[model samples]
Target: MLRAYQFRLYPNKEQQSYFANYFGSVRFIYNQMLADKIDHYKKTGKMLKNTPAQYKEEFLFLKDVDSLALANAQLNLEKAYKNFFREKSVGFPKFKTKHKSKASYTTNNQSGNIRIEDGKIKLPKIGFVTIKQHRDFDGVIKSCTISMNKAGKYFISILVEQETPEWLPAEHKIGIDLGLSDFAITTNDSDESVKYANPKCLDRSEKKIKKAQRALSRKQKRSKNQEKARLVLAKK
Candidate 1:
């Protein structure tokens, strides 16, 4: 089984600058690949064959960031293009914009180059960063994704692969149906059925949630109070 554990990161000023560069580099590589792939498809009805290595020569600053992050960006762009052609449900890959895109990058773990040591987690290029591991995980670490939220909070999501015992299939199958009226209804092979009531968590708090949001909307945009109110609404 593959599990993910997330921990809050407390990086110093220099580390924060490095993170900013990494995020920008990954975004740039992704956007560049997407654009080139689109143009390639238009010209030859095929995906582009560009790699991140080619960009390093032109954009020397890319060398400052984690190379694996840029490689992952290339892989992500390729997957997106593949999905667009192979699956009709998804649209063509879009260019990433620094302003609206998720500020994150991914790096792989090889020979334990990345790990938690001496109360800090090591990342490629950047040294150990202080991490708050609220919960402990004992699985083998596979990769890590570093992300920064809109509120400027940094987090590291560690993907871990663990071996789990295989489970035997149930002798009987159950059918499940969900609805707003009832949270869920289940029927077994014997035609026995049971219905679960809706928790009505939000339904019960609708008025309060609406009032808080209304108050939030009235606050000055981009103000500290507005930010706090936004957090309150999100919690609801």
Candidate 2:
């Protein structure tokens, strides 16, 4: 069985710079390979086979980042192509833009290159980074994806492989009916129904979110204040 656990990341200045490089490098490689594939298809009427290794000589900076990250970018391009061919509804892959694209990169664990110890996570190319591990997990590390949100918060989701637990026989069964006013109405074998009230999470925070959004709208576009307001709104 495979499971994924996500934790907040706190990287220092150097590590943050490395993360920026990794994210940019992955996006660059993916877009470059995609463009080449399209041009090759247009000229030769055949698919082009390309790898990050072929571009290493031309782009020396690529060598500074994790090799696995580049490889995963290639895999992502391949998957995009496959999806387009398999389903017409799934459009062709588009180039990633710095402003609009997601800031993230994925890398696989090799020889224990990725691990958690002493309240930190070890990553390839980057040294141990502080992590807020809310809970502990037991499994072999498989791969991890590092991402940064619009609010400038960084997070890592670690994928793991583990054995499936044995299931125990059920002694009773219940039927649950979902609703808007009530969260759920569950009835057991005894025909006794219990209603759970809706928490109304959005209703509680709606005013704060709206106020932040209005503040964001009043700021000048592309200005530092606007960016700050956007982050505040995101947090809200």
Candidate 3:
């Protein structure tokens, strides 16, 4: 079965910059190919097939990123077109805009191009970067996808193929029935029932939260005081 392990990444300033560059390059390739296909269909009434290799001459800057990433972007674009035609419910592929889209790029790990060792991961174009592998896993690494969230946090998800045992229904399973008053009513395999009370932490923190929210409303937008109030409210 396919499994994925996500780990938080800690890259140096230069490496983070490189990550942005890669994300932009991959996004550019995807958008460019999609736009080309649309234009071709409109004019010639036929789909124009543009591969990643065909884009290199026009977009020399794209060479800065890992070639595999660009190829995958094209693959993803083609898949989108296929899905749109095959599945009547799906919509057409849309263009990707920088800053508006999530920053990410995926690279294959064929022939051990990508590897993890000693709390570090070796990625294409980017050297060894620090990571927090909190959990241990066993399997053959298949691919690695690097991504950054809007919060300025970076992460890497490693896809792995493992020899997993077939799943079987548990003999001693428990089913929980949710309730409005109680947290839940759990019925175990033995047919014994247990009731759990709801933890009303919200009732305790309601007053402080309301105070912070009020203070936040009074502060002017884009002002330092407002920013501070927001941080305070977030902490609460």
Candidate 4:
């Protein structure tokens, strides 16, 4: 089994520029490959094959328009297309935005330097990137995926291969039914007292949300008042 880990990279101004260039190069490759597919299909009535060697050949032409960093970025584009065709994954490779989420581009892990030491990890184009170490894992890392959450936090998810034991105990088995009013009822104890976390907090929040929604409904769409009302509702 394969798993991925994501880690945050704190690049300086110069490194940021390098990252931007690499990102732009990968985006261009993705768009070009997409266009290439469309053009080939229109002429041959067939989808183009996605192979590493095939993409490597296409990347050779990028020499006229880009340098080694740009050429290296195409590796990710190739993997993207490979996954798209092989796994039937949605969302084909596309151009990236300036302020996009984490994972601007992916490249080969040639450096053999995945862990952060001295509060930093060395990166291509970018020098050592500062990172706060989270929980550590014990296993051979298979892949690393870097991403950003909605709250603007950078995370590194490290994928590793691990073996887990399966449990096959038949001594304790019970059927349970769950409902809105009652949480659950076990077959062994039909009349057992069900545990319930008081719903007073939930009811209070629901009432506040309802009030905010009603206020928002009264406001006209696209109006400043409507926007304010929307914020209130969202907060609720």
Candidate 5:
């Protein structure tokens, strides 16, 4: 069985720069490969065979980042193409842009290249980075994905292969009724009912959200202040 655990990441200045490079390189490779495939299909009516190594010579900066990260980008593009071809409802792979695309990259574990030690995680080419691992699990590392959210928070999701635990058979079943006012109501075999209150999350933070939105709206378009305000609003 494969399970994923996510933790917050804290990288130093240099490591953060490396992360930016990795993110850009992965996005660049995916978009470039997608373009090549589209052009090849248009000209020859066949798919093109391309690899990250082929472009390393032309784009020397790509060599600075993790090679496995770039390879994963190729795999992601291939998967997208396969999905589109397999089902028309699945749209064709679109070119990734810096502003709109997700800021993330996945790299596989090879011979224990990815691992956690102490309170840090070791990544390919990026060295050890501090991680807020709230829980512990025993498994073999398979892969890890690094991502940055709109609020500029960094995270790492580690995928691991582990033995599935055996679950005991249930002695009794409980009936659950869900509603808007109350989150859930449950009745067990004894017919005793319990209600869980709905924590109106939006109601709790409505003022803060509106204030952030107003601050975002007041900022000038394409300015640094606006970007900061946008990030604040995203956090809200």
Candidate 6:
């Protein structure tokens, strides 16, 4: 079985700069590869052929084109293409933007170590990333992908291969009905448990929001009062 472990990264100034550059370079490479693939398909009506040596040569070309190491990045790019072709994702790999909410990178299994130790991890180009290690990972680390979220937080995802536990056959099955005032009512049980709320807060919030919206509608458009009302309503 294979699963992924996502962790947070804390890189220094230099490391951050390196990752930024590396991420842009990889995006460029993926776009170029995508264009190359399209051109190849158009010319021959089949996929283009490239040996591992050719990929290695192209990987080495990063030195003359840009700074920082780009080894094994090609393999990940290739894998990304394979996944895209297989329809695992919506679209193929494309260029990245700095101002975007999620902007970061990935490294293949080769050319680097995605080692984990004592609730921390070490990534290529980006060093020593700390995380809240929830459980022990008993497997081989395959790949690591780094990215930021809409909340402006960085995360490192590690893919690993391991054996999954076997599931037991179902002995019996039962259905329970959930209610607002009551949590659930089982077919075999007569009593109901008060485990969940009746969503009173949501109704209160909706009513308050409607009141703010009504107040905003009373103000004339393009006026300062209208803008202030809009801001106040938005905060609701």
Q: What TM-score does candidate 3 get on C-alpha atoms? A: 0.82
- lDDT for every model? 0.89, 0.95, 0.90, 0.59, 0.93, 0.65
Among the numbered candidates, top lDDT falls to 2
**Residue-wise lDDT of candidate 3 within 1-236, one digit each (tens)?**
89999999999999999998999999999998899899999999887888988988888998787999999999999999989889968999989988578799999987877888899999977989999999998888999899997557899999999998899987688999999899999998889999999888987698888999999999999899987898788667
- Model 5 lDDT, residue 67, Cα: 91
How do the residues 43-148 of candidate 6 rate in per-residue lDDT, one tens digit apiece? 9988764423444366674443222234344565667777887995558766545544246556656544668776668765456767667667788888777776
In terms of lDDT, model 5 sits at: 0.93
Q: Quote the lDDT for 71 in model 3.
A: 93
TM-score of each: 0.75, 0.93, 0.82, 0.52, 0.94, 0.58
For candidate 1, the TM-score is 0.75
Candidate 5 segments whose C-alpha is farther than 4 A from its true place: none
lDDT of 1 by residue, 164-226 (tens): 859998999999999888999999999999999999677769977898889899999889999
Ranking by TM-score: 5, 2, 3, 1, 6, 4
Candidate 2: what lDDT?
Answer: 0.95
1-236: candidate 2 lDDT, tens digit per residue? 99999999999999999999999999999999999999999999888999999999999999998999999999999999989989979999999998899999999999999999999999997979999999999999999999999888999999999899899999999999999989999999999999999987878699899999999999999999999998899887
lDDT score, residue 102, model 2?
96
Tell me how many residue pairs clash in candidate 4. Answer: 13
List of clashing residue pairs for candidate 5: none
The top-ranked prediction according to TM-score is 5
Candidate 2: the clashing residue pairs are: none
Candidate 1 collision pairs: none
lDDT digits (tens) for residues 1-236 of candidate 4: 45555556665676556555555555666666667776887899787754333454656644433234344455666677668767775666665554453445544344464445688765544557677656565655544544444333445555666666486777755677776775565664345554544457788999998998899899998899987887677666
RMSD of each candidate relative to the true structure: 4.8, 1.6, 3.7, 7.1, 1.5, 7.5
